[model samples]
Target: MELLGLDSFNLVVRHGGFGAASRACGQPKATLSRRVRDLEESLGVRLIERGGRSLRLTDEGAVLHAQTASPVEAINDALNDIRAGLGRPSGRLRISAPILFANTALGVLAAKFIEAYPDVILEISTEDRFVDLAADDLDVVIRANPRPDDTLVGRCFMRNELVLVAPPGLSRPARVEGSAERLTFPAVMRMGTGDDDVWTIIDADDGLPRRYHPKAVLRLSSPLTIRNAVLAGAGAALVPRTVVAEDLASGQLISWGTASGPEIEVWVLHASRRLVSPKVTAFVNFVCDHFNAPTR
Candidate 1:
């Protein structure tokens, strides 16, 4: 049934007559009467007993008034709430992020976001894959080195580089004979990595690039697991500096060298087809501010 007609019928019932309802709401009496008639026709029930002495309700009208009165009021309240909070961030916002980013920064970022936007209910999921935002019903996503997508838009919030790190006791390898400082070391590597996988590191002092091969002693999938292995003296591995900043500072892990020309670009993204919601906008601003990074 038409909500306007139902509301008009309720108004007429609550006020005792069409004229009274019109006077109370400043609507034309003809409009209220016509809407009530439309409501009755739509419901296939005569609601009001017309041509009565004052205003009388048919049996069906009485039941409709009893059943729909409170529900209509509730619907109106919910609509009003949406209107009132339109300028504010108030809703459920589902987000997807890479696993390593979530493990490193998402917890603290989520805490601050919820504190600032108490109205928004935030749900975050951590996975390493680039998810389909619309298909997954996600409001936002965070990724690293996100492939070019014309359908996605957002800001780059963090830029970091990969570095070779090892336990404090593990010494750097000597340069290979008859080579331009090429070396090999027992290294923890990602699963599926080739045995002869080579890494290039920029020399900190000489500002020259050097090639090194990781003799894979341990192969793990998760970056966090690899970092832990390096800390436990399993072997050296190339990892993101931010992920192991504390370990390097406290002398638990030593940096062998910085990975050559690798920039880890972290981005926050959302679907570009629809209008951005207030909650998503608020979150984007919050993350950019935290990292002091510019929007892409």
Candidate 2:
């Protein structure tokens, strides 16, 4: 298989169609189609099925793409390394991030990052779902409380414990720890990992852990939505303090206490590779420095 054809095929898959790939790379649409067709003919296997409304990758196509995407990237990185020689970060940097974080905070961070490194072209795709670094062709992914994965490596940039918050007009519930007649407050909550609806938190005043039952009146999908519900006096919600910090300071929201669960840790990670790209290192260090983390 010709390397040019392989590159064209990957580009088409990456951009979702030949036309889009042409538009993205400023290549002739017919040339890309011919290259991809040549690539399939050379490999003796059909990669993209174009008989539908849009192009969909066949099983073989997916496997080939996943197998080749990183190696091709490594080749590009090698060339970039030789030319740039640890100079200013350059090239397209693709990233995946969580939805709420992207909407709330990422815009500002992207602006600052771009201002600092003008040569690098930043592309961000926001989704709450986990994505593959190689399969998705992404340089980095930002996640909250990600499980241990040997394939990934990075540093936690933000660590804030969950806190229960209510509207400013709501009165604090009477603390009745371990009491049979404990108060169950009306709360806007997401589905808990456990079966029971309860808030185990550290009392801000006493600095001791407390348990409070929460009756979920409305179930929300994301913390951002829960915060909105809490703001509308829908009910109390367990959210990160950083999420509601500004509201608390403005006296628009009141924190009941910090939850006694794992801290809400946000991390920026990339796939573990032999030679880390300068752009990747630059972005990671930029994030670490912004978050006051000395190192990963």
Top of the candidates by lDDT: 2
Cα lDDT of model 1 by residue, 1-296, tens digit: 57989888888887889999999889999999899898888889899999986889999988887777645644553564478575577767889998888988999999999999888889899898758875455778999999999988999889999988989789788666677765888999999899878899876456667788889999999999999999888999998889899998998988777987759999889878666767778899999999998645
Q: Mind giving the per-residue lDDT tens digits that candidate 2 earns over 57-143?
A: 999999999888776766677577668765568889999999988988889989999999988899999998879888778889999
TM-score of each candidate? Answer: 0.71, 0.85
Regions of model 2 farther than 4 Å from truth = 1-5, 16-23, 26-59, 84-86, 176-181, 191-195
Note the residue pairs that clash in candidate 1.
none
Model 2's alpha-carbon lDDT is: 0.85
Residue 82 displacement (Å), model 2: 3.6
TM-score for predicted model 2 compared with the true structure: 0.85
lDDT of 1 at 51: 98
Count clashing residue pairs per candidate.
0, 0
- Cα error, residue 188 of model 1, in Å, equals 0.3
